[model samples]
Every structure is written in C-alpha cells, then in structure tokens.
Target: MNTPLRRLATITLVMFVALMGSATWVQFFQAESLNTDGRNVRTLYREHGNARGPIVAGGEAIATSVPVDDPFGYQRTYSQGDLYSAVTGFYSIANSRSQLELAENDQLTGRSDQLFFTRIRDLLTGKRPEGAAVETTILPAAQQAARNGLGAQHGAVVALEPATGRILALVSTPGFDPNVLAVHSTSEAAAQYRALDQADGNPLRPNTHQERYAPGSTFKLVTAAAALESGDYQADTPVPSPDQLTLPQTSATIGNFGGGSCGGEQVSLADALRTSCNTAFASLGMTLGEDVLREQSERFGFLDPDLAVPMPVVESVFPSDLDQAVLAQSAIGQRDVQASPLQMAMVASAIANGGRLMTPYLVETVRAADLTIVSQTDPEPYSDAVSSATASALTQMMVGVVDSGTGKAARIAGVQVAGKTGTAQTVEGQPPHAWFTAFAPADAPRVAVAVIVENGGNLGNEATGGAVAAPIARAVIEAVLAS
Candidate 1:
C-alpha cells in the first residue's frame, strides 16, 4: 500500500477501537449506575414488572405492590398514605423514589447483594422474582397518637425507644398522601406531585429528620450536661439568675421569658433549668465557653453529617468559631444552632438511657420473599453523651420542670415525666416555634419523645413549648407506655 493509504487504514482502525472501548465502558463499567439512575425509564419499567416487597410496621404492610392491568405488572400502594408518607415516601413512575422507597430500593426491588441466593433460587425454580420485606421499627399506637396530637398543625414529632434507638414514631404534618403520586398514570402522578410541591409547608418535606429548627430551651439540655460534666456545677450549685444578662463586649443583653426574675439574684442550677431561665444559661454558656458547648452538642449528635436511620437524616448544626454574643445566643439554641426533632429526641434518649446514646435506626429487619432473613440491624452505641450521675441529676431537674415549672402540661396522671420546654424565636414579628422533649416514668423510661410546633401552631405568638408542644409530647408518651 502507498504511505497515504496506510495512514488512512490506521485512522480507521483507531476509530473502530474507540467505538469498541466506549461500548465496553457503558455496557460494563457504568452499567450499575446507569441502570439505577432515577431518570432511566427502562429500569423503572423493569422494576415495576416485579412484585416489590411490602414495607411493614407493627406486623402490617404499610407499603405494598399489587398486580395491575397496565403494561407495568405491579403498582405500589400505601396504607394510611398521609400518616406514613414521611416514612414510606412515594414510588412514582413520573418521579424518583424517596425516604425508604429510595434508601432501601435495592432490597425492596430484590436487587441487593443480600438477596443473591434468593434471586438464584427463584431463577432456578422458574418462580417470579420478588423483593425483600422491609420491617420498620414504627409503633402504630405511638404513630397514631402523634398524628392525632399534632392535629392539622405544622410541625414534627419523633419518639424513640431510649434503650434500643428504635424509632417508634416519626411524624410530619401537614403531610401529603403518597397514593396521589403512586398512580400509574405518568401525567396524573406528575400533576399531583407538582401540586404537593407547591402546597403550603411543602408537604413533601419530612420534618422529623430531614428538616432543622431552633431548639430553644430544649437545647439547654446540652448546656446543662456540659456544666455537669465539667466538674464545676451540680444540681444544687448556685448560679447567677439575673433578670437580664448583658453579652460580653456588646450593649445587647439576654433576658428571662416575660422579663421576670428566675427566683432570686442567684439560683440553683436545677432551679434555673426547671424555670427555663434564659439569663442563667446565657451566663453559664459564656462561663463554660464555646469549645465545651460545641463538643457537648456534638456528643449529643449535632454536627454529624452522615447519620442515617436507613433514610438520610439531615445533620443537626452547631455553628463554630463564634464570638461571645453569638455564643450566648447559641448557648440557648438560638443564633445558628439548629436541630431536627430526631436529634432532640436522641438527647432526651441519652439522658433517659443513663447517658449512653444509641445510634438511631429505622429498619428492624429485611427478609427475602420466601421468609428468610436477609439483614437485621443491631443496636449500636453512638456516644456517651454524659456520665450516668450527670444524667440522673439532669433527669431530676427535668422532672421538676414537669412537676411545677413551664412543662406542667406534659404531666401524666400516674407517671413521673421528665421534660423541658422551649419557645424559640424565628423571623421578627412572627410567632416563635414551640418545642418540648421528654421521657416518661423517669425511673424505668420506655419512650423518649421530641415535639415541635412551628409558628406556635394555632396559638401563634401566644404559644409556648409547654402550652403547645408539651401536651403533644404527653400524648405520645401515653400511647407508647400504654402499648
């Protein structure tokens, strides 16, 4: 061949090799990601052809796949759609999956490595492929109580078994019905989703673990734990209780709720906490300094970016490198200190569980279609948030709050409830958010709960965590204990 002809032949061969390489990369190396992509229409159709597993709670299926007369062999359906929306989320043909539907998609679709043996058996026996059942830790009674307690309000409630870190109840309202989005019609599902997205409060957002809020006096639990752990304070230790505490180097000052005195010029730490004294905690926070407070906050699970109760939990935040003024505000869960209801519930759980903070988890077990267990979550410790002695002291102080202070609404008829109430300020002129966190039967605690009512619920500016949020917490505790 001539030199030009030889060069032309080499170029053609190079082009052919490039095409082959691209095909191999897409067909092999990138196959998994491409197949799992939410936008992949073919993958969605293929998945719908199989019988997806049921998402069970309290031994009943909350989410299940049923045979349909459409091209897609199965259709997803949710029981009590609005109540479980935050947990089950929706599996839609028009949009991506969410919550458990997204987090456990592999197991739910029978594609997880844990299900390999089951898949092989089904293939060999010529049986229809089926996904693994996902059993959640949700308690139906507690969940229903939380829903009824919240009652058409905008907020969230999280209840955890302190000893196990099993989420008993997780609720966010006003919630959207997953059924509306689960319809087989792509156009109908898309339209319904758009409406829910644009609705007030964005019903699609799960507030229990996905959203954050100022914790208000409820965060004083962290500050109090810091003080007790520092070896400088005790339940009976007298701390300054001035009506107004001026921040360092700034003219601005922090005052007690309703501008009232916290008993006297100096009050016991327990008394200050029982009264929810802002000035006292602000003074103590400045005294303890930012480092101690931040570390303590993190120990209680703030600033952890990767916490997942199966579904991803948006990390609670405690801002760093703050000056004295911001530190004072943050010390009170104001400023930039933000937390989810789940994080606050963990704080109460740690205190209830003798200061051992267990890692929170949602899914209890995953079982193959034939009823063989594929995976189970073991209870694990997340941190030692405080010493047992410190937790006891805090528990006693919290009980006092429920007995005589601002948290009286959380009182149970025959049970000793330990709790803290918070009224966190938000945008200027708007009502502050109401918050309450507590555990019941303090001596042998069964349930730890956190409740937040946004914009003071129906009371607006008139809402205090005690008046608005505490009762909700009380109802949840009652249900958990009764069950």
Candidate 2:
C-alpha cells in the first residue's frame, strides 16, 4: 500500500473497530433498559403474544389481557376502568406501562421466579397451564364508600388494615378511564397512551401513595411520637404557655388553629393534642430540640428511599439543621414537611400496632389460574419505631381529639374512634385544606384512614377537618369495619 492508501486503510480499520465496540456495549449492556423502555415495539409484541394474567379484586376482573383477532393477538383491558385505574394502571401498546401493572408485570403474567416450580409441576402432570392472577388486598365495599364520600370533591382517601398493612382502599378523584388506550394494535395503543401521558391533569398519580401533600395536623402524630420518645412529655406533662411564641429564627408567630391561646396559661400534653393547640406544640418542639425530634421522625421511616409501595412513594421531609423557629414551624406541620396519605396511615398504623409499623401492601398474594397460592406476605413488623407505652399514650390522646375536640365528626357509632383533625394553612390568603386521620374501635384497631379535601372554599376557612374531611374518613372506616 502507498502512503495515501495505507493511511485510508488504517483509518477505516480504526473506525470499524470503534463502531463494533460501541454496538457491543449498547446491544449487550444497555439492551435490558432499551427493550423495557415503553417505546420498545418488540416488548409490546411479546406482551401481546402472551396470555397475560388478570388483576382481580372482590372476585371480579379489574384488569385482563383480552384477545383480539389481530396480528399481535391480544390487548390489555381494564374492566373496572377508571375506578381502579390508578391501581391497575394502563398497559398500552400506545402508552407506557406503569403503577402496579408495570411493577408486577412478571408476576401478573405468571413468569415470575416463583412461577418456575409451578410450571415444572404442570409439565410433570402433562397439562398445559395458564399464567397466574394477582388478587389485591382492596375491599370493594370500602373502595365504593370512599368514592361516595369524596363525590364531587377533588381529594383522596386511603384506608388500610392496621394490623396487616394491607391497603383496603386507595381512591383519587378525577381519574381517567384505561379502556380508551387498551388497543389491540401496538401503534394505536401507543398513540392513545401518549394522549393521557401528555394531558394536564396528571391522572397517573395514585395520590394516596404517590403524590406529596402538606400533611397538616395529621403530622401531629409524628410530633406526639417525638414528644413521648424524648422523655419530655407524657399523657399529663404540662406545656408552659397559652400565648403564641414568636419563632426564634423568623418573624412568624405560631398560634392555635383559630388563633386561640392554649387555655389556662398552659396545658397538659393530652389537653394540647386534644385541642390541637399550635402554641403548646411549638413549645414542645423547641424543648425537644432538632436532634431528638428529627431522630424520632427518621425512626418512623419518614426518609426511606426504597419505600415498600409498588408505584412511586414520596418520602416525608424533616430538615436536619432545623433552627428553633424551623422546629416550631415543623411541629405545627408546615413549610418543607410534606407527606403522602400512605405515610400518615403508616403513622397511625404504627401507633395502633404498638409502635411497630408494618410495610404497607396492595397485592396480598399471587395465585395460579387454578387458585393455588403462589406467594403471600406475613404481617411482618418493620421496626420497633416507638415504645409500646408511647403508642398507648398517643392512642389515648388521639381518642381525646375525636371525642370532644377537633376530630369529633369522625366518631363512628358504637366504635371507639381515635383521630386527629387538621385545617392547614396553604397560603397567606387562601383557604386551608382540611385533613383528617383516624382508626376505629381503638382497642382492636382494624382500619386506619387519612383523608384530605383541597381548598375547602365552599365550606370556607372555618372548615376544620372534623366538618369537612372527617365524615369521609368515618364513612370509609364504617364500611370496612362493617365487613
């Protein structure tokens, strides 16, 4: 080869080697991500070809892959449609798969690691087998009750079995119907899915566990825990002031919900929680200091990165370097402290279950088409996040809040209800959102609930959680308890 010819040949070889190396890296290393990407047509082809399993609740098919006389053979159909859209989510050839549908994709389709042994057993018996089904912990009655209670209201209600952490109902208003995107053809499904994905309402958020909200006074549960754990406050421990104390690091003054001073120039811990007194609790927060309060909050799993929920779950925030003023504000559940309904439910569950917060679960078990149990979850205790004594004391305090204080509307007839009510200030001028959390028959404590009603505009700023959100929470608890 001459000078020019040799140079061209060497250059060509180098370029060819580099191209091959790049192809190898992506085709092998990045293949899983690329193929699983919602836009991967090949993955859609595979999903449609297989007889994907059904997602059932209350003995009814909420989600299934229906066969269509098309080239790919089938499409995912949602029977409950919009009612359970947030839970089952949408598996569209047009849009991406998400929520429980995507998280449990392997299990729902009966190709999970646990299904291998069952498959072998079927082969040994010389019988062809269908994929498995996913039975969620949801109770239809409670789900309907929540839907009815929140009718025409733009908020969410979540109820869980406190002992087992099995979510009975997860409801978010203004949801979308999944049927519109369950197209048999890949291209059509993809197109339909993108429309919803691009829409402004953000219908995909299963608000109970996914979206973060100002926890409001429901967060007082955590503050109470911090108080007890610090050894500073007990059921009868007294707070020292009735006046709103000016925040140390800022110009803000923390006062009671209605700006009423805590009665009698001071109040006992029980009385403070019962009245939902902002001043008294602000003093408690300052006394506990950042270290004690933040430590207790973290122990409650507020900052967990890998939350146990299937879809995204937002972690509760508690600033580490909290100033005296910041501590006071956080104690009243404001500014940068955000949490989901699931988190509040967990807090209530922790108190109900003697300070042990079990990880919340939606799907209780996965079974074969023949009704064989493939997998299940025990009522496993996550952590000894609080002392048993502390839980008992907190339970009593919450019960007091409901019986005669702010959460009175949450009382269920014949049930010993324990609850906390909140009317959290959202903005300087806007009406605060109403929040209520409760668990009933306090002794056995079966169900726990957390509910939020946005704006409370019609009801006006005077809408405490008792008058607004508590009734809804009560209805859900009654429905579940009746069962």
Q: All candidates: CA RMSD in angstroms?
A: 0.8, 2.8
lDDT (Cα, tens digit) per residue for candidate 2, span 443-482: 9898988888776724867777889999999999999888
Q: Candidate 1 lDDT, tens digit per residue, 249-328?
A: 99999999999999999999999999999999998998999999999999999999999998889999999899989999
Candidate 1 yields a Cα-based lDDT of 0.95
Residue pair clashes in candidate 1? none
Model 1 vs truth, CA RMSD: 0.8
Model 2 TM-score (2 dp): 0.91
Error of 1 at 199 (Å): 0.9
**Candidate 1 Cα outliers beyond 4 Å, as residue runs:** none
Task: Identify the candidate with maximal lDDT.
Answer: 1
